[model samples]
Target chain A: MQCPSDKSKSAMLAYVLKQYGIVIALILICTALSFCSPHFLTWPNLITVTRQISLNGILAVGVTFVLLTGGVDLSLGSLVALTGVVAASFAHPGDYPLIIPVMAGILAGMACGAANGVVITRGRVAPFIVTLGMMTIARGLALVISGGKPVSNMSPSMTRLGGDFLGLPIPVLVLCGISAVSWLFLKNVRLGRYIYAVGGNENAARAAGINVNGVKLLAYTICGAMAGLAGVILAARITTGQPNAGLAYELDAIAAAVIGGTSLSGGIGGVGGTLLGALLMGVINNGLDLLNVSSYYQQIVKGIIIVGAVWLDRKHGK
Target chain B: MIIRSSKHFIGMFLLLLSALIYSGCNRDAAPDKKTATDGSRQLVVGVSLMNLSSEFIVLINKAMLESAKDMGIKLIITDAQRSAEKQVQQIETFIGQKVDAIILNPCEVEASSPAVDTAIAAGIPIINVNSATKSTPTAFVGSSDEESGRIAMEYIVKRLSGTGNILIMQGYMGQAAQIKRDQGADEVLAKNAGIKVLARQTAEWDRAKAMSLMENWIQTFGSKVNAVYAHNDEMAMGALIALENAKLKDKIVVVGVDAIADAVQAVKAGRLDATVFQDAAGQGRTAVKLAVKIAKKEPFEKETFIPFQLVTKENVDKFAR
Candidate 1:
């Protein structure tokens, strides 16, 4: 029989493969597309893919925490819409300082997230139902606030948040910052350890004196704030407070997390994997666009790839 | 076995044919649909709309409602809510109710047409509005999507002197507006061989998405794109944002469609070069008017086309109003 060390080493190898599979997939797609499209490997095209993926990347990082804690937030998309229009309303030309509108948008999402937490914890409602209901409410509120149209003409300074910083686009920088901070948070903080415990086994966590509800509330609230930040970035980038922005975005975020090998049952994921998953999605989109593939076939190809990824993951797990 | 199966097929076919004939002639039984016999300058017209949530569709609904009030016509409106099956059900309900005539703002091109056929088979005159159906109706009252694109392109060709590099921001692919608008742009491109198309992609009728797409194009082909032609105003407004950020606002001449309020403001401010006026209110009014005419058996044209006009800075006010 193999020694315990050898078995654990094999297990470690398996874990790494499962977790870093998305990175490998992204590299392969990039390599293939680099050969297929003459423009695919260029610096400008790669930057385009990174910036395009940033919004969804930040959202995936946020939802990754929620999924790790054995819950899902379906309201992220609508929350993005709500925060975006709110940010645009305040960020209108010379209306307010840039920070005020930016914070206002993030705070709105936090409040909405906090409320979702309260209902799920205090009211004993399921996370899916609570977030689903909030999804509709938030989308309707976005429509009402924006009067069923896009809010435009945001301040120039406000729009600059979506522009370049140093050498990189502000959104990609923001995405990088969020990912680093999230990685550290998961690695270092005491609450972070408690989060893993709570997700691993709620009853065991409660027995161990971990505040399960508090940890859950923290996860969901952070998810909300991230969603808000994403909203601000998109609105500023587009220079509009669009109520219709981020439609069905939650699906993409969830898909990224899942494709990155995050367990839906709880307690197994990280920002690194999520980033790779987001990059894979971004590369696929860029590659398809570069090849001038019709959006219809693009959708079909994307769906099949997602399904195939999950199927391979499941088989690997077995 | 072949003979037996054929007999079963014949029986099912006969059953369906008789059912259609029965439903056609005995339409007076349903308590919901009022017959024209009791009418005294009172007409009941049933209308099925695509989706009520869209701002443009809401404007269409408002115009129709206003026309209904002014003409003293009783209108029963059904919201299809973007579901083709729901639209089919609404059309069937209109048929069963035996309304004088039916107005259909189709949710889809083909799925919504067969139901309109059912209303026709029931002897109900149908008026199709805005988007077309696969099968023709008694009357069609709306501006063609292709015509909107043509008006925008014609103006662009004039401004560019028939030759310039341009970017095209499309709507949702396979959507009626996207296909027809691209056709119009392609027709213009075909004529002006000197006009180079730098890039074309579907932004899916989204402002934020379009803005990012424009930003990517800027990165890929900076300073090369001389103009932008968006399938809709939302995308145009987004392109305007990207251009303004890159300080290309003064260089590129951008045009769009729909003439939505924001686009109108953009045009008025001289930020957007031009936008094609889609006349949502006009389509709504004409649909109602045609429905009443068909109900009253008054003389009317089979198809009424609303003209799409280019809304440049010079003619912005007229289109805006």
Candidate 2:
């Protein structure tokens, strides 16, 4: 009943809405917050918000790869703790160079991620179950390694990772660098394309000569490494490697990815959208704190926004 | 085919769950088996701590272990892991074993009360340590949470000369410590007409969280914040770090409850203005002593209120050791 051009035009519009709607939602929330709180729009406050979201943003980007491959990494929070302890023990005053601790933390995370990948592929277990097991194992490992106490007395250089560099927080700069690189990889690389194909349809991807298992292994390893990096940053910022840190952090990262239009079923999302999602959450939290809103109400408001944003995007997408 | 595979998965899941549950129960039952093997007429006391992850709770646990060894008492200590239900189950296990007494570091005033009731009903004398439950125990040993809050706030008020904007960093919201500390702080604040509370929020008794919250508050309140009162030393340390980073520590007076080793050290170094001492060692030793007294049928005080002391630079040395 409609002309082909008109039909294609409507389809394109729908595609754009589904892809970039979260950005618009984020902008609207920021605009609203600016009207509510004078502090919300200031340069310093903006920098603070970015600094706060940097950890989650790094995590969200890492999980975006896993989500794109139809897998999930629930052990992210535990890995943060485990890697943090490993790094902090190495980072004590004059014990090792800053690179050693940073590398040790990330490598520890990568090893755990590789373990998750092996179990999921070799054992033929579901990602959810495999990751759930790793979650407990990693937490226990962190406790065992740290002796159930926070690791303190970190070197000044290590703690400087949480400070400013060239007028920008180092953590935020790390997030930006990671996001830029990830965006390029996902957009241009063959392995990255295979990630989408595998998640889109496993049998079809296999028929197309893609190494499905390898791609999944890579996805999980990358996620774990990101979690490791986040752990190091958190440890540096807090000036202690607390074994109990990063509780429920995975939930926030996953929420950010989901809010960015990443499907739990996979094969749909990118770094740009994920950054917007993390930014949206950061802005809301900063805004609420600036306005002196009760944390009880802030929790309720956060829940509503997460669900509402996703629901709206899905509805408009159709 | 999907349904059949799902059914297989469910069966496997159940098997794993049962294995986990079995291991957990075995861990709890190991001490009872050890007690039976001893076969000596040694008095046994089972202690259910609120959570051993906290440094303060660990201190209490360490002191309890030491005193129990000295007093020749067989102690079965279990970490409740912040779950009242788990604490109740642990008490029930202790009752089944017919321990001489039970010591409860309650997780909640109401939720943990059920554990007290179950213990008392089984004719077991339960000694509450560190915190309280709604249902009264045979004996209690701890400093008052409210008193610690009052002491810390009163110190801050005095430093500010009774006129300034202050911030309150709470612990885990709705916890016994959080509620009573807020109440005690309010009692002090209400009397001071010039002092005003600029903002209050929970960092969930976490250092990193408090740091982030403090950073945001610094951006929001800036120079207006003259003082900060944290529910615990960990949070106070966090706020102090944030203030130091922002180059505002010298201007702002910071205080916290629980004169933890680090807090005491900080006070001595002049990094922290003050902290209230809850005397974890005192509470732990007293609880063990009282439990032994109840078991031996010796007269003991039903309530032992260990006084909280304010730890400032002047008094830091006395508490540091």
Candidate 3:
């Protein structure tokens, strides 16, 4: 084993650098931007950006898990809306018992994930196509359930997730906790190794006696669960379960994952890098507002940055 | 073999427990109400809305329903979700249900013409609210986007001393609101050469995108940018966040249309300079009134323009929750 150790060490170093290159670049960009703009480094602005990115970050954690297993989950966005609406239905004033809605939301997301998993595994459908169909169906169900309305008048207990603690949002803390758990799972758990093995080569994993289908199913279910949790936080933040909430959020999650150096090809990436990518995006958005830039050109710039990131990744392949 | 048998048993028990839990939860939840009495002389007014995602539009829908109840009319509302085709289907359904009148917030000014024509051919009176379709209806009731834009521009000019580089955040292109608002802003720009229009782009009424776009604009123009004009409160809120992040909150003036609760709060907090209040609730109520009057064969104006107010910190407290 020691004979080829030197070459492997260099290769591992290269892989690690490739995985975190975008994050390092983003930090550099933020540092330079902060120097250019006096307001960029302020405590209030940093808190605002962190609060804004928390929900997306939490959702991205689950999405990263699925992506690591070489699977895509488009239904995550719709699941968020569905969970939010369902959870809000359980909300009542002075209801200190928040378990009902939280559990309901989690169950709803898990059920949706199970459905996606069953459809893909049992029906022998591609994950992309299956999840895409699930996306439309789930969104329609959300509208049908909510009657094209915003579910408002939520309980204060439910609203506490969006409130501040020591000048930081509770949701941000939740995001950090979720990220920590994801880190531990991906780095140390047997299931995490199985996910990487399955993603790296499904046939090889099956040959090695690993349950490939089961691993993929678990990945999607976890993604769904995380999306549901994100939905609850979103509903609390907005104080409403908007039928149209989380529309196009899948794109943002995918973008964050890709920017964080998660290979679309799978078996690569981690929650830490995804968090950094999401923060980069949040900072850019917040900094732009502070600078008073027009919204139209902002989109073009964001698209260019996304494209540029992928190009950079390809150039420095892991 | 014994260990395998125990694992199977545990799995089966968990499955059974999950099923039981699901059923129990389902039973406890209230059943959806779907029954409605038929054959009454109740006036059914069909409302086809463009979108219900925003708080402003949601407030308008609630107000419309409340006004309809007061006017002794039954409301049948459908959200188009920003799809013209879906709105057309909803209108067809309304016609099938024999609705007495139709109130439409057209997704597109031109694409809604066919549906408006169908409603007209069916002898059902149609009223346009918040926005108008290309095909004229019996009554059009909503704020003048052009006027609102002009008011927003005037405020920006006064704050910037008639000279500054302003960014214009446009809405969905080809839509009535976008067209009129841009026209109004252009008219103001033509008058004041001193006030430069640095850049103009469409945010499509998304806050996150608006914030990102504003950030790039900052990188491009640096400190030359003086103010931002968003088409809606959401975009304005996004722009304000961007400005705050850049430490330009107090120096730059930000204006947006639709005095939504968030925008109102922003104004009160001195984060946003001004926004045009279109009176969404009033618009909804007036549209219902016009629909009822038309159903009753009473005379009403063909085009009813609602008043718009430029709400600033001084007046935002009255509008804020």
Q: What are the Cα lDDT values of the candidates?
A: 0.84, 0.89, 0.80
Give the winner by lDDT.
2
- The docking category that best describes candidate 2 is medium
Q: Give a tens-digit lDDT track for model 3, residues B116-212.
A: 9999989899998988778988889988889998899988988888899898888876567888988888888889989998778776776655665
Which of 2 and 3 is the better model by TM-score? 2
Best by DockQ: 2
**What is the model-wide C-alpha lDDT for candidate 2?**
0.89
Any idea what lDDT model 3 has? 0.80
Q: Which whole-number lDDT from 0 to 100 does residue A116 have in model 3?
A: 89
- Which residue pairs in candidate 3 collide? A288-B215, A289-B242, A289-B243, A290-B242, A290-B243, A290-B246, A298-B213
Residue-level lDDT for B196 in candidate 3: 90
Best by TM-score: 2
DockQ, each predicted model: 0.29, 0.65, 0.19
User: What's the ranking of the predictions by lDDT, best on top?
Assistant: 2, 1, 3
For candidate 3, the share of real interface contacts preserved is: 0.20
lDDT of 1 at A147: 77
Chain A TM-score for each of the predictions: 0.96, 0.96, 0.94
